[model samples]
Target: MLLQKFKIKSMSLLTFNLLLAIWLAAVLNVPFYERMQSLTPHTGIKSSLFIAASVGVLVAAYTFLFQILNWKWTAKPIAIALVFIGGFASYAVSSLGVLITPDQIQNLMQTDISEAKDTWSWHLVVWTLGMTVLPIIAILMVKFKPEPILRQIVKKGIASVVSIAIVCSLLFVFYVDFAAIFRGNRDLKGMISPQNMIASFISYYKKKAPKENLPLVTYGTDAHRVINTSKPTQPKLMVLVVGETARAESFSLNGYTKNTNPELSKQNVISFAQVSSCGTATAVSVPCMFSGMPRKDYDERLASHREGLLDIAQRAGYKVTWIDNNSGCKGTCDRVHKFEIPAPLKQKWCDAEGECKDEVLVDSLKSYLASIPAEDKTPQLIVLHQMGSHGPAYYKRSTEQFQPFKPMCSTNAIQGCSRDELLNSYDNSIVYTDHVLNQVIQTIKDVPNYQTGFWYLSDHGESTGESGMYLHGAPYAIAPIQQTHVPMIMWFSPAWQQHNATEVSCLQQQKQALRSQDNLFPTLLSMLEIKTQVIDDKNDMLKQCATNPDGKA
Candidate 1:
């Protein structure tokens, strides 16, 4: 009976589309309007005119899209899908300040189930139902008048043409205002609700979805280990610790105010002061860093089918193993040995959600090394991927003992908390990460006769309420420095450093030089002493520091 009162008995399909467009322009675009208002200060008459023009353009744009797709069977389905997407997009923008770009969509698609659960909250549930469900109900209740197919087609075509003309005319008249808003702020396009989400989703799938079968292209086929006879006779073992969401600005080792590196400071490690990430998200940065492809030329599709550092290292006779505590290896460990936290290890370190603190990585690595046969000591390259400072659940990342900073934010709705609370929680996670890295260094030190070295590099950085942004995965070109500048640290056992003739003093001297994840691929190959045509000497940061004993290198 309630539904019957609101039902439309006779409405043309074009009229239905117009009403939908008005709802989308007026209701679903609150975030867009707020953003524009913030950008353009109130200048009385001019400000009012700009706001009016912007709404007109937005309504016309949506009207054009709806009119073109005005089939009897398809129009409602498309409208319903867009309404739901718009609602979620608005919430994400207003609450978290995340833009819906292709990279962000890719990150969402690749996120694991446990990680996805961390983003859930009661606020989100209420907001989603209120924004999307009510509108969907209203859409379903509408009843369009029956029309002949030929007449429907002609009428819809005319409506679309009229919408296009209106949109073009409004945009032309407000050229100066539109240009000022969009020219400097390219990411503003992502602020528009359903349009941005729709375009980004389609763009991501078109680029990333699999095509016809293609053979994998392997690199460094002629790769072979060049053993440093001067080194220990046992074997060479290097541990690469891939950190998650750690920004250089937050690390004391990189001049941060907090003492986030208490344990690391005691050790003799060189912290690279100026290091940039390949991308603002792990899905792109992790694969790109390993692919030996520089950031500028990296194509995720191509990187997936090509050999990476691990593949080439294994080919060169090193026992390459990837131990993960965050998401899966993102296909970086497909050709090499991979390890996950066993049930026993999880019992000791993991939470109810199966999200483990990074200490599990250290514990798991220790157990794995212990199980290896005493005599079978082929050189080892083990990667420890840490779940460090992954937000908006930063408080969950560190254990009670590791959280030094007080009055921390404990909920998933990080934006709702005070800024100090958020920073404190995030900093405590870094402190815990410090402990994990120290443990890794200690574990490698205890290994008997093997020549061991350690390298720590964060996949990317995070944004902490900067410029109305939270989290990471902003498009690389427009990404803030917080999301691109990452922390990197390197350490080596005394025996290993002496054996490889690596000058620690030289490395420390060059710590402030500009470097990036691109240096990782070739530098790692150089550290493993693998001989391959693929290793570029210019990209290796260690190349300048090597003493080149016996003039072999």
Candidate 2:
């Protein structure tokens, strides 16, 4: 009876399941493999030999892991989980042709279900089943090899060590060639799927664990909005819009061929033509923009702990309010008075099965501003975070009225569509954005009481199938212009600028000057006329051109 029971606990099946995961991880990562081969230093035998050794080392190491799993109590469950990780990582790798860095993992953690929904497709569903779920079912059905638990543990542990040693020895022999290839393509290290995901998790945990304890550092406690008693102007009410996935190249104001900015172009808005984003992802850009630190000097953990521009503005006596329609301000407005539209749901801004229309933002703000006590005339800083042109479902961002472009790419997968169709879909989204901005500007005007102004900037730009790249979040250093160059526009009512002594024409002349998210913190403080030791003059783009020629107080 014991011998018969051994058939159910088949050791071969356990090893097979684990090996299957390794195989799927490697085979599905075609881009990484091809990129590695292309970067190999030499040709012919030397290259072939190096590739073989590299593959051998990887397979041998994973094989050793199988030996270790073969001895564990929950071996099957662990194996199945690893398989799923490998399969999902494959989907991610295939879609982006990019490595799964720890930062990407962090970004993934911040992504809402609505964002994740845009990534799904029939191809992904079919591939995931074939690669992961079906295999798991097969593994569960497969019989296992059973030996005495104590003996099996000892035997497998010994064999695992031996296998690991053999792999290390092989690696040592081919160390020079292997190192050269990997060093040339450092990102390829993370392309090794299930291992990459495991590494990302370990990295995220290490970074978050100790850093979470850091206390929030305050800045500009003496912050008070500067009111020029000599000029004697009304208090300012400014709207800071943080846009999503809007590339500079798509905006007509920035000289794009399309009329993507027909509505915005008609307004008295200063559209900065040469502005760049700090990061290629919202997780990086939003927080970085709010930080006093520039992108090159910024640290996510340190920035998150330190006081930021919004907090400083808050301390300065602005009745600051953050109304979010995008992914939750990336923790930028956490300390301020904030409201978030419950996503993937029907808010007033939401339509067509849960996509929030930008109009929802303008309407919501109108209602919210109306509720503010009439007695309080304190300067107000309102932030509207828009879900602008967030990809592959670009068709979903705009309403039917905004779909001027015909038969745009309605599918979530941009790669599946023709280039013209993809551009059409994206342009239509921008047209919708123009409409939203027009509404937002009009809403501020309707309020009719204070010096009203609006500043619009995107968190990051996006790749619209540019050079075969889609979506965003490539490393900033290596990212394409399409993913880094973002649209930035500012609108101030003529009366508002007149009261505050801002020269709109002067500001417009600086449109061609190079600027970035680094300008946001200092420039915004300048806009509110808040001056402090914390404000860096070098980072303020508007300072050079914002002044009237007469230098009037």
Candidate 3:
């Protein structure tokens, strides 16, 4: 009789488990399985089957526990919370390519309260509440009750405990195996643990910290200070456009099908199609791009040793200005003239809903430029960091006026949107970026007594429906081409070219040479005509341009 009772209870638990599995599969979207399929060329079917089976087992176990505990009331709320928490948690954790923490959350909150407010409204409160309440109402209307067999099965605790233990063990094994696969790659390591993610973020300013504390290496032996600038005949202006979430595969300059970079292509911009990023995510790529250390050796120790590009430019006697529309994490331009806009905008640029366009940063740039004296002899380096293509709300990234492609835009998360829609939204952002770049270029061109040169590079790229991965921040080892390949372009006006013709020609020649953020420092120094004692001449792109006037094909 006891054995018969156990069998009946097990059957009821299995039914509950199956239902739970379906819910989880629908909610989480099983990103891991999708990722695995992308990695395995011919084994997609088999890999998907395994993933589905694994998810089924997990859901069954969880449901079995719910049945045994008789805490069905808690399931609705817990599942609802998990859905909402999971989305933002996934985005935040994936953005950093690591684990989520309270401190990071606090930092995000402090950086932009409006961003936090939107997250609360769109993702947390609305999404969570809706998911939780809707399902609960449906269940209540159906008058769902536990089967008598299920109740009887729960009364006998031994079977339930055994089932729970087995499920927990399986989950532990899976996690351990997954972690082991990513252990060797530092990028993967960051994706696993948010705390150990990018080692470049120095929460507190430390004067006595190691050489890597700064993002870039200095030209002088003194390390902390900039080297004396070499005298040049013409005044120089260098504008660096730091783009957000821009991938290389989408740029027409890089041979993409869509004419996304039509403006840049017309302007004789030098596009480096073969360029690869140092890191997969913005948090890792931004600091890594500025830091002297390669991605392989990038760590807290190296972070302390290097100074950022802005600091280097400042030390070289150039007035440095940083205008940003993105999160100012890692304090990259802390010592420079930094203008961060406050959240909850009162202007039309920021709507009543608190959504603001990235073009507003251009206004801030104009104000900053107007404040600078035209007669100032010191060279100037201005950084314009755009909030380009930051997504999930890809439609919000750009207005309809800039929409180059039709049938684009991801309106809802659960509504099955095609890859084309994602691409449309993303491409529209690129179109908007092109407009902004042209505006900045024109502004710099208008400056008197100064020859302007512009270079644009994205902090990192994004994944749009590639291998079922919709966004970026994958572990570097496993990251797809969409995340690592980034758009890099440079524009040199005629006046600037005439003054530094040799340097400009050299840059053009070696434009296709394999390069990463490791070369940005030396390259920038070469452009500014700053001769430092510690500069790595070999890795300097400009120096390479000077030495190898005709690039090796």
Candidate 4:
């Protein structure tokens, strides 16, 4: 009866749906649309017709797949919600130049008010209005058809099939041109506004649903530091600095043309030239790096449940704490003492209500380490997670002193800038990271009581206009080199090596070998002189460089 009383025109309903698809593809997907449009200049009637024909195919396919929204009871509300969410999330990725992966969704859900405030802008508000709000209001006001369900299905299906056929025919006619365009711009598909987010979320949900809330698996429960003759008299303090988005391609220490590592290069640091990250995003990389499993065998579902480096360290009689200046340690530090960037840090170092410079991770950090109530004989493991080179506001990361490159792309809307400008902004952030690491080393030197060593490696790397891709989070199987090749540098004080019986020269030579985040677990264990049941000899880079408590080489 309700359907009969409020009947709508079939043409009106179908037209609205088609128009919605067109708007989403052509307007909401700005990054993708721009790339497609730029492929062939709007030269004459032929180019104009090509653009129209290509768009028609896309909208037709969308209409065909979206006919599910014609279902009687549930489809309308769900479709509406999807459109709304698509608009909002699309705005986020568009403004931030980050990928819309499941990890990103999780991060968005977990973001605190303080972390969100810095992301707001008038530009974002206008973009949202244009993308979804007006469209939503228009969609709601438009009359929906009361056509018979069977007829609706038949009609929409035929329309969809015909649209797809037309697209196929067109592709066959212009196969060569279309193939080259897709080949050159493979990443354009990831920029498809809300459709990309929706697809990613659905795929993520399906994979995650089965293993939701599995029991945590503990490792090294029987862990205890052995009584080694080589154990230093002074308690050890080892800092593991997990950097965000610091690619080796931008670092001078790794042979980049730019002097992005001036401070780090000056220090007695050994830079591992060839280091790969476990994953391209923090959510995957952080847990994977800490897991005992190597990247090839890593299971994302198992990562959350399994014990990581922190748990093993804590079990091995080390007082460990995870201090985060970026995303919360991605559940890698859930079992440990986790500290956010101190809320009281001044604006010079951090913005309590917004994005904080990576410097805050080390500012007065030595004093805090001194305060850790470690048992007299226990060593300390401090994990400093930095917000290094996180984009698209790369210019904000570095202070005035470190801006070696001029004319940076300062805005969060990074795609609008030239590639050189983007690289300049990204390289500036690298310099700032160098400065922060130098300061951290200085603090370690100031602490006279403990024999300290620092190991710094990025969580993952960034993609700066490489192959027309803007940020990280390409699937790991085929992620670009820029997104996987990260910078790993280490500093071992002379006192630290001598006191801990570490052979610094031997460790430096081992730096030439290929390594990954998988090495962190057993390598650090070797540095701490803690051997556990789970330690893999092949992954332990430090075993040959340092002796056990009995001092056997």
lDDT of each: 0.87, 0.78, 0.62, 0.75
- What are the per-residue Cα lDDT tens digits for candidate 3 across 283-304? 6677667765567777644553
Task: Sort by TM-score, best first.
Answer: 1, 2, 4, 3
| 1 versus 3: better TM-score goes to | 1
> Which residue window of length 10 is worst by lDDT in model 2?
544-553
How well is each residue in 1-553 modelled by candidate 4, as lDDT tens digits?
Answer: 5545544544444566677677665666665555566886456776767667676667766776666564545545655775787787667556545556665655456555655654566677787688767666555555665778677777777777787797788787767767787787665565676777777677677764236577989987777776657643677889999998889888899889989988888899989888899988887788889988899998878878889889999988898888878868877888887764455664567554566787778874754766766556568899999888876578888998999898898886676788788988999999999999999998898666678899999989988877666677776755789999999998987777775544566567665567788888888887887878888876777665444432222
Compare candidates 1 and 3 on lDDT and give the better one.
1
Q: Residue 322 in candidate 3 has what lDDT?
A: 82
Per-residue lDDT for 451-509 in model 2, tens only? 89999999888887665467887766567899899999999887777765444655666
Stretches of candidate 1 off by over 4 Å are 1-12, 38-42, 145-162, 228-234, 545-553
Q: Top TM-score: which candidate number?
A: 1
Write down the TM-score of every candidate: 0.93, 0.87, 0.70, 0.82
lDDT of the structure predicted as candidate 2:
0.78
Q: State which candidate, 3 or 4, has the greater TM-score.
A: 4
Clashing pairs in 4: 228-549, 229-549
